[model samples]
Target: MNFSLVREMMRKDLQEVRKNGYVFYSLLLLPIMLVVISVIDSFAIALSSSGKASMLLPTFSTILVFIPAIITSLIGSTSVILEKNNHSLEPLLATPITDSELFAGKALAPLSIGILLSWLAFTLYMAIMDVLTYGHLGYFLFPTELTLVQMFFLAPVTGMLGTFLTLLVSSKMKDVRAAQQVSALVVLPLLLLIFLPIIASGSDLLINLLAGVGFLIAALAIFFVSVKAFRRETILISWGK
Candidate 1:
């Protein structure tokens, strides 16, 4: 593993991703949208007499988990597909870099972007919740133990899962939209997990523990499998046609 080559590749991929205006715009807008939604929810909770605004925190955390995954999937798949269509990938592959180096470089940008943005969104969400509920609850009520675990532990894994699945699908499919559509399925189980409280019976602690363990295992498995299966030869062959 050549660290220099990996860094160079990551730099190049980041440049390419930055060139896409839509990706930049989407990244900019997503956090704002999340803040707006959360603010509105807080207001609604404030007006209601249920006095269970804190209970909604988990649901908000669950929703925040998806933001980075969706963003990374779009950017990751599009990055690979664009490189293929633009005839840039073959020339890059022709260089002296190894397949592992190339894959790591490609995966790093989207994975980092997703994780960073997810954490930022989570921070904003936490801030909003604390501000709105502090007046009502008489204390700062966010960054709970479970929320901390979810943000620091589960979110990165979910982002990596999205990045790996998107890159895998992109390498196999010529059509960007097709690759994205297929890669999107990787989050189906995660989406279902958001509804766990309603569909399954368990204490919050039990559910959070299960979800954290599950996502960590899945992320590690996907990362290894994706690295093993993503051959430079296969990607070139698929794109060449």
Candidate 2:
């Protein structure tokens, strides 16, 4: 793989992601609101019913854990379609960059942003959790082994799955909005499998681990398969249609 080419492509995409106001905001707002609302609600609950705040941790964390995947899908799904609409894609496609390089480049920006935002949000959430739980547990209990795995491994894998699926979906789409809308579906499977808490016990731990493994495998397989399956001509034809 041409690392330079991949980096160049990633750089260009990142710049474009920032330049487009609506797209940038669309990518940024949901996760921020999600984190902010959850933290504020939990803080409010802790102020009132200290015992109940702990109960909300599992479900809230489960949702927060997947924010990266959500952000990835939203950004990834629209990445290509937006460029195509702007007539910027053809020039990029005509370059000497190989499909694998281009694919990696396209995937990097959304993947990086998704994971980075998730970590930041997780940090805020941890602080909130520590404060809320301190009165009861007397110490910070967040970022446990399970949380670490979810953030570092499971989340990225899930985001990759969404990225690859959305790229494939976007290939046939001329409309960025429609592509983004479809990309939303990719998060559902991750959500169903990663609910490791608030299920009456830790029984879901096994399920979440199995699901994470499955996502990692699927993301890897799809990335390689999609690179081979990617057809520049098909994309051109689809845009014309």
Candidate 3:
């Protein structure tokens, strides 16, 4: 892969995303809103019952983990569809860049943003949980090993899964709305994780390790399938259909 080409494509895509007011603002706002909601929920849980508040952290983290994946799917699908609409995709495909490089470049911007925002949201959540429960718990109550693994490992993998799925769907579908609608389904697995914390009984370490490894494998499988399925010709021919 030509790193230079991938970097250039990523830079160009980032510039375009920044220039689009709606996309840029939504990307900025969604993470903040998610963090705020998480904080409020944490506070509510603390007030309701401090003991249960700690017990619910795993479930809360599981739900919080999906925010970045959701953001990436929305932005990634919109990015590809917008490129097709703007007449930019064909010219980009005509260049010397390989399909892998193109896919990497296209995936990087949203993936990076999603991962970064996911970490930031978690960081804010940890801070809020620590502050709000300090009086009751008398110490920092977050960034448990499980939470750390969820933020750094599971969250990024889930974001990548969402990104690739969105790109694949965007490449196949002509309508941005339809592509986004289908792409939204990619987060279902992550959403399902929320239920695990309810019924799961084990050391936090074991549960997180199992969940992280499972998600990592799923992400790798999706990445390979996406790379194999993505075709510049298919995208070009399918345009405006």
Top-scoring candidate (TM-score): 3
- lDDT per residue as tens, model 3, 6-108: 9888898888878989878878887788878767876886788768777775556655667667877877887766777889888888899887888889898
- For model 1, name the residue pairs that clash: none
- For all candidates in order, the CA lDDT equals 0.71, 0.72, 0.75
Best by lDDT: 3
- List the lowest-lDDT window of 10 residues for candidate 2: 194-203
lDDT of 2 at 216: 84
What are the per-residue Cα lDDT tens digits for candidate 1 across 15-49? 76678787677786876787678667656865584
- After aligning candidate 3 to the native by TM-score, how far in Å is the CA of 114 from where it should be? 0.8
Candidate 3: residue pairs that collide: none
Per-residue error (Å), model 1, residue 136: 1.6
Off by over 4 Å in 3: 185-203
| TM-score for each predicted model, relative to the true structure | 0.85, 0.83, 0.88
Clashes of each: 0, 0, 0
RMSD of every candidate to native, in Å, equals: 2.8, 3.1, 2.6
- State the lDDT of candidate 2 residue by residue for 1-241, as single tens digits: 9999999888888888789888778777766787778777667766687666555564455556677677777788777666677788799889998878888888898888888877777777777778767878676767666667666776777778877866776666667777776677645454445444423343245655776788788889888777876677766567534
Q: Output the TM-score of candidate 1.
A: 0.85
True-structure Cα RMSD, model 3? 2.6
Error of 1 at 4 (Å): 2.9
